[model samples]
Target chain A: MQSQSDNEYGIQVYNASINPAPRCPCVLLLDTSHSMSGEPIAELNEGVKTYFEEIRQDDFSRFSVETAVIAFGASDQGVSLVMPFTSCARVEEVQPPRFKAGGLTPMGQALERGLDLLKKRKREYRAKGIAYYQPWMVLMTDGAPTDQWREAAQNVQNEARNRKLVFLGVGVGPYVDMPTLTEICPDNRPPKRLQGLRFCQFFEWLSQSMAAVSRSSVGEQSVRLPNIDGWACVEA
Target chain B: MGKVIYSFGRFFGQAIGHVKAHCPAPGKDRPWCDQATADQMRGARSKTRSEPQLVFDRNGIERRLGPLMAKGGEGKVYPLADHQDVLVKIYHVRARNGDRLQTKLEAMRQMRPMLNSPLFGWPRLLVFDEAGTWRGYAMRRLAGVQMQTLCQPQLIAERLPHWSRREILKCARSFVSLVGKAHRNQVIIGDINPGNLLVDPQTCEVRGIDCDSYQIAGTTGLHTCPVGVPMLMAPELLGRDYSRVRRTFEQELFSVAIMLFRMFMLGLHPYSRTYGEDPVANLKSGHCAFGLGAGCRLPRGPWYKIWSHLPFRLKDLFIRTFRDGHGDPAARTLLEEWNDALDEYLERLNKGWFDPHLVPSAPKSSHYRGSDSGRRKGTASQGSRLFRKNA
Candidate 1:
């Protein structure tokens, strides 16, 4: 355990109060439903790796980037750290943990899990006296969830709408209702489509954006975002 | 009062050794002189010393002038000499807290690495002292008049009754270039009001001043952060949290747009029309100038009339930059737009449309002497209280 002033662990005590590192934590909630079994899965995995690789190359994203991966459909594919944000040098240092595809798409469970993780991290930050910006939860799906997702989706939507989390949803392939995804993300609109093989592009943006928020000295604003042009296509 | 008096006493204490070694007092031993009386005597001797007498002074520097100017919020600005003409800014520590001082000083220091010849002429910092109880610094001084005085209707009529279109645009471009330089360097001068900018009469050059609240990138390769005055701060910087990074080039571009709007429209803020009953409350409520009836005149029906005279896209971008730049920092104009608009504006200005010198204002030479020999009360307390040397 590092001392509060180490700044890496987000604990920063000043004038008798803990001044925590103001970092933004981000999670990529992916849908590996049965429909996404073959090429989509392979592309998604490659895209995920590419996301890590691309994010580390950015000037601002290196130290501030943290990642969590939660994939639905595969019972074994529980939410786990694709790459934990620490004082790590490169994203590749942490191997991209593999997620399988088998069960029904339980997006609610995945989203709930992702939110829980973010909440836990936030609590940790608060305990350590590190300040943090709004955490981002990005949901990507190919099909609708099999579980009673409305309640979970509504909960997620409420949190996102209230800005409790910076929520973004991306609909990929076909069968996933874009309008439904949009409804889930009322505050920032709904899931944008992964235009072409643009998962890399979206993740690249995510990494850079998170890094921008992270690398900032604990009290900076979350502005100057990367242009949304090259990433996901907004469903007009 | 006690702290000031204590600090004043300390100021003399530090200077005593330097004073004795370099310039001896007029009367060595005046036993009848009281402590206050002795302070007055020492203060006079410290002000004016022969060249050789000043050489051996600490670090070969000498006092150039006593406290000459004081702004309402900012502290006093004094002219000093240390092989160069410099302005010493002494902040009233009591008025500003430690965190604020730390924030301001750190932001200023972050810009140090990127300091080159700024287009609007940035004064280089010579020293930054937050050690002990007080905080202050010495910086290069620019030869200029306050922009606040220049555009005043009364001052304009008396100073230069007829400013040509070309001179006005050239001066406008000069101001833009300076702002452009700051953006390029990843700095945002949050206080972009006219009162904070200085203009040189001889060359019609502009320089940014009162930079204690400016923001820049952290020195250790951290993200670009936000800093500076909240009033002139971009919406994003002021919203949600205080940023330690510089506002994006896009946001800076928006600031440039607003600055130009003020310059061209005769110093009117876009939202000034609604600023009647309570401006502060409106600002807090996120109400900016865009579509309000009177304040919108510049960019709306009448203003767009003038804007239409300019190139299509450039005018559109200018309006969009400010309009979109209104409530959200995220939606501001990018650097590409600013650079393009600036290029267009410069080309237009260079075509003999405006005369910068003709802008209504007193020529700097009339009121501002490069060297103002104001009769300073030569007292030890005054001299000591004037500037705090960096440790």
Candidate 2:
């Protein structure tokens, strides 16, 4: 039988053969407003599915990456944490929720939900004394937020600026409020405008980038990410 | 991940002779070459060289390209319209510096040792655009389930359900031998990773792909492997420029060790079990956790059990390499040492000293009873593939 040995921190990591290896958690905060009901939602679902499929094929990404998905702009007028953080190793069991676009774009609430989930996940990591990479939040939206976002924006600034998180804001379509998205992002990194409805390329880049980062061993020096030019368009 | 595109110089180097001239279309006169260009068919001057539909092989056989098959950061790969078995890898035309890419390809083309081997996806046909600009080359397309699937537990259990310790070990040994063949030819698979290899599920025969990235020593000069992943990089090559450094065999062996470790230990990076820190840091510090064993903070998992179940000598080989080899290059385990250890392990397996269980969920570690099996003296260490009747 698999037995637990006392960890250096002396915490009881209660499990057998299920010891969590170092993890890299990333939360994808997506916009599913009513305007995205048709082609946009279909394309977005395909893209998210492609991301899972690509990460499933990669050994490094398969073993280490943990993904949670959160959606905003549902009928409830609040954010829905669609999927909690699950190991990519359990890829077959984990499915990207079939998102149906409905109501107000509560961008602020989604960011808060993503941040809260990340915080809780990090606590679990620390409790087990498990090593982890800085968390990543990829926020994609096609339209402007309907609610107040100043607190979420400030939290993103602090988390990203303090190096606790790698937050990226992606403007999905022409209707996006670039200024608000920029305000939410850190100063060094600006929100990237997604070209057309190329959600497939964006998620491929995300999965490939995560694979590289999770495989990377050092804290200093940034890991080289896949080129963003494929999906991100130049801002006018 | 910079986008690397080679510039096309006006001049074209002399093409090497083709191994076989593919007479693609029997009745059609030279397919791409004999067919009048759209401009010729139209009887008008071409529009800025137009799209290069025709590419000339070394034997001057002009071939037509089919629809694009696959694309990557560097370039796109296409298959010959008539010759379905042959695929061509063409670089993107962002051409900044063409000479280096040309020189590297030209040099590699001259290395004939890789020509007949199915083990490597070596560039076989030198393909040039109609303008005589070196675009890319063609190779026999290899078909197999990518080794990445074989490495992961969940995937392997589903894909190769019949795989056990014997199959995994046999595959690993075959991979080592293939790399040995490449090394003998002075070719170093500079970016060694599971992603770059393909495995035949039936025979567990591993085939290495992405030959363009190989570090090959040409008759003219050394064509250095320019790019590498950090996880596969050797210790001394940590901060060094991959383009400038000439990788030694000993250094290359370290990466071999890493890949071997992943294959044997269910895809765990040697440094991964580091008590909540950067795993690669152990590579730099020369303080690998495996050597410490019971003293180290090895979490309760299948990996720990595998380590515990590993034969003592094999564990020592890994320890010496990961821990001691960090400081001294010579301390790293060599291919022959691996062969020896594997030979012993095979014997132990054959004699039923241990169970032939290799899955991650392999039960708690009491299988190693090699002490009772007793050591076989003077067993010829040449690639031991023999298995006992009962095993």
Candidate 3:
């Protein structure tokens, strides 16, 4: 048996009270490729920081929402779990990894890794018998996938269709392949194109949606998400 | 950072902060000055700061505002410099030109009769900026714990650890009574969520805040509440374009039922279950697990453990409100009915008719495992049977 001090995904397993409330796991799969070096990368950093701040302010979401950050195309790691699943309250204590965008977008590898992390987290929740809302996978990219992505898209489709998770695809700029995003998030809810560099508004909407999900009883009813008119628009 | 700088200035600038001077007017001492000394000092220093001071004209009497106390989606609430009991909410630039916002504020200003109740933090005066720009209004600040803290099970368990089922029931009663009083005044609490209510745990007194958002009946030219919190909205309102639909008393009643359910049922939402992934889907489909129907069984855990302790009449009311009234707003339980049921239940508990100690524990086998044998044997079993038959 593992020791009491053992940690899973950077979280201390023995600290049961770290997340005594029901959990809402959210994985942010971001593309930090060469195309996202200057303003795009800076805005993305600010947006993620704002998201954490907003979640921490909410009393329920602070304890319930667990966020993990996965970045692609930054280094040889291909897909790096820069930040593991940590409660919103504790996320502020740790410094987030700064991204210096370079290399190609390895979207397939990131999706596969994100899925694996979510599955492992679910297993942990089950082992502890902790009730949880369906996990959320948010994919944001400014370019097309430069690697084999068909299998990863299929996996996302299966999970979304089974109602096991919610996948929201956000095309950050005009360069993103809208068709692939539609294929990856194929739960009748099409991917939305982020209007301008409204990363703050997008993250605000995500936090609000997470708060709604965390407030409700897990596994009972579908949370009605807030209107996305503020940050997103239909692709032309 | 600003507060630290202000504190340093106060301690050093006033000669070790021991400067005691006589009242400005001789022989007429300020009784409230002792408590307001810090505020006066801050007021003195703020004169040099560049932060904009909001100016409010309350019935021809102008009041200058201090710093912001809090901010929300619509506006920022600032304390009135002259009035200790009042706070002015100034609409942000985005909300300044909102449709019919002024007419709504005007309608609220005319509601003097309903303002008599302490349970409501009703708007007292219409306000504007120095340039005659339509800002927002002023209202009495409620001093108590947020209802979000009281209604959330985890917060209640952590902060108010001594609270029991009796106290929860008392809180529920107070909520229902407040709703009833608001309804009597022809005001519909359109945005009926935990954030809009505040509770005093010691006194069990419930006060409804954000009274300006309520839909006032028969108010001409008033804009209806165009938005609602999805979790608290009625099932019929779900998935609909909110801007096209005006909220009614029936919708408010549905929200009241949801609030009462969360309070008495340990924060379990009426439509929440372990099987579905989407609450709005469950609500739209009328798939409340706690109600009467096939497969309508309460989820296992703390909720199931203490459910039997609830009085039968209240259980029936829950069933009626959640099940029968799931789609039909007319079938929903009235606020008066909820008030009476909660009041009677508390009365019975106070009279020693119900034994608090006998409230059963969870069975050896968890209900999540689908072990029917572990189900309660008395009122719960009968209630489920009645629910099935009625369905």
Candidate 4:
């Protein structure tokens, strides 16, 4: 026994109820080249899972943290968008895809793809009038790029300098070139070297940092990041 | 019924057998009597290791825990076996230091007499583990949905469609009364948000939960409520280190004003606009869409139309709270003033100034289609102006 107006109002009310919340988008740019095979790949998988679990537990982050995982050197395409941007709640429901390291490192292609996806997502947010934090691109690798990477590094530097995105580069194991990571990351902050295969601790810090960002008012000058002494050492 | 009688003797250890004789039949006036008896029997028989349990002592009173009802960032809430009216909250093992929590709980117990009113679920019993580790405390278990469910206007509209404007007004009045009672007791509800209040839809009764977190005025050396929800926090507290700051009554009043605005406006936050994407930023910048001659006004839609139906006195208070008092915490509306204004609004509604159902007018044009373009155009012009002013 509902009238036309009542039905229309119901739809409007429903739309209002499901209004878009402010979003904190994070892109995980992972390297799955042959060097990451064994313990490194296993630990990285566990870390990603832990990251999702931690984000899901936070009430605000579950709705606000939109995550996308893109892996390089894991597929025939050189780089693969393993998971598109999804809320932490949805990420928790799906079993994270297992990474098998076999191909050559295509870090530049992966970085470019991650930046492209983040920019596209931001545009969608603007079109839909959704509020967002500066998107985060976390690049973790253990080896040098097999493909050309100067342009990708320059793109990251430009975005980071403009305060358009937060680019945190992490070099894993002794084989990683720390100097390259510094060049790729923003000038204000240098890249950090992961201690041992401590991917779990690293992701835990990332999750906590994202939670802090999502908690603050959007468009604030800077979010106070939690202490990162647990899993990282400044790359010398 | 016979099983309950037989088990009652074994459960209460014969002392309460005589009381069982006076127990009424099922579905009678004293239904809780049967429930209590059943609970005792269940307690005596069940010794399952899988079921989590905690034991705690308040003064000399010992309370046995039951199944967990809910869990949060701080602790787990379990119903008391013998007492149906009370529930025990056991804090997580890593919550602060044991001695500090003990001191805080003891202070809460001292404040019990003033907080015994029905509006509060104040801490009544201090709980501990087997090794005397200070865990958490017990308080009254409020039976109802969280006020958060009704914080938004759409939920209220959909859930309580039959409700008139009078009923909604009554709900707001109940909320104000609860806050007034706490203030009278000299307790600052540090984290005042919809999640912390429980509302019984049928009776319009509002009860404040998480009383353990309330800042007791003069409890020296006790751990205070250190944090607040960002959305509910006043502008001054937004970017500061909250753990170091002691929240005052004036700061709490700011949150109260925001809550009242939300309740009266259906779920629309005074700072919320279709164009403005960040609510926290809007609050900090004092961009109240409903304020008079404001640059960023509420989108011209159903919500704006509904605003016209509000009583002028209440509207004026909202403007004062969000606009004039936006920068200064002391300028916000006081609890007593809110109580007075809401009471007057209720009186006028009773006198039939307008029908509540008639106030929520359906949009003439589809808001989704028509308002979006207009809102974008408005945002392009007004948004820049507001940004410049704020800067």
Tell me the lDDT of model 3 at A115.
Answer: 96
Model 4: per-residue Cα lDDT over B230-304, one tens digit each: 677787888877656777777887788888776665545566654565667788887766654665445433554
- Ranked by DockQ, the better of candidates 2 and 3 is 2
Q: Please give each candidate's TM-score.
A: 0.40, 0.76, 0.67, 0.65
- Give the per-residue lDDT digits (tens) of candidate 1, residues A1-236: 43423322111211111111234577878887678777778777877876666555532344345667777776555344444544223334656656556667777788788878887876665443233566778888888777666776787877766666778888887687777787677555556788766766776676656654643433233344555677676666
**Candidate 4 Cα deviation (angstroms), residue B199:** 2.8
What does DockQ give for each predicted structure? Answer: 0.01, 0.18, 0.10, 0.14
What tens digits encode model 3's per-residue C-alpha lDDT throughout A38-115? 999999998888788778767768778999999998877777898999885553374655677888999999999999
**Fnat for model 4?**
0.13
Query: Which stretches of model 1 miss by more than 4 angstroms?
Result: A1-236, B1-65, B81-84, B95-135, B160-162, B220-231, B236-246, B274-314, B327-331, B346-391
Better by DockQ, candidate 2 or 1: 2
Compare the candidates by lDDT and give the number of the best one: 2
Q: What TM-score does structure 1 among the candidates reach?
A: 0.40
Task: Tell me the whole-model lDDT of each prediction, alpha carbons only.
Answer: 0.50, 0.69, 0.68, 0.68
lDDT of 2 by residue, B1-391 (tens): 2111121110111111121243233225332222212111221111222344777765456778875665544666666786544677888776314678667777776666675576777776567876777788777655445665554565565455566777777888888888888999999989887767877666777888778888988876898877676666677888778889888888888888888887777666676542445555556665454654323544334565455445567767777777778768888889888888888877876776655666333423333234553332112111011101111
Candidate 1 lDDT tens digits, B1-391: 1121112223234333334454333234422112212222222221222221111121323344443333233445554433223445655555455555554554554354333343332323333332233335545444455564343333333232344434445566678777767766766665565656766544567777666556555444433233343334455555534444545565565556656655553333433321132222333454443332223312111222222233334445544554555665566666556556656655644653212232223212212221211311222122223211111
Order of candidate numbers by DockQ, starting with the best = 2, 4, 3, 1
lDDT of 2 by residue, A1-236 (tens): 21232211111222313433457899999899898899999999999998888776665677678899998987775688888887667555767777999898999989988999999987766444355788899999998989889999999999999988999999977788999999999999999998999999899889878877765654535776767888999766
lDDT of 1: 0.50
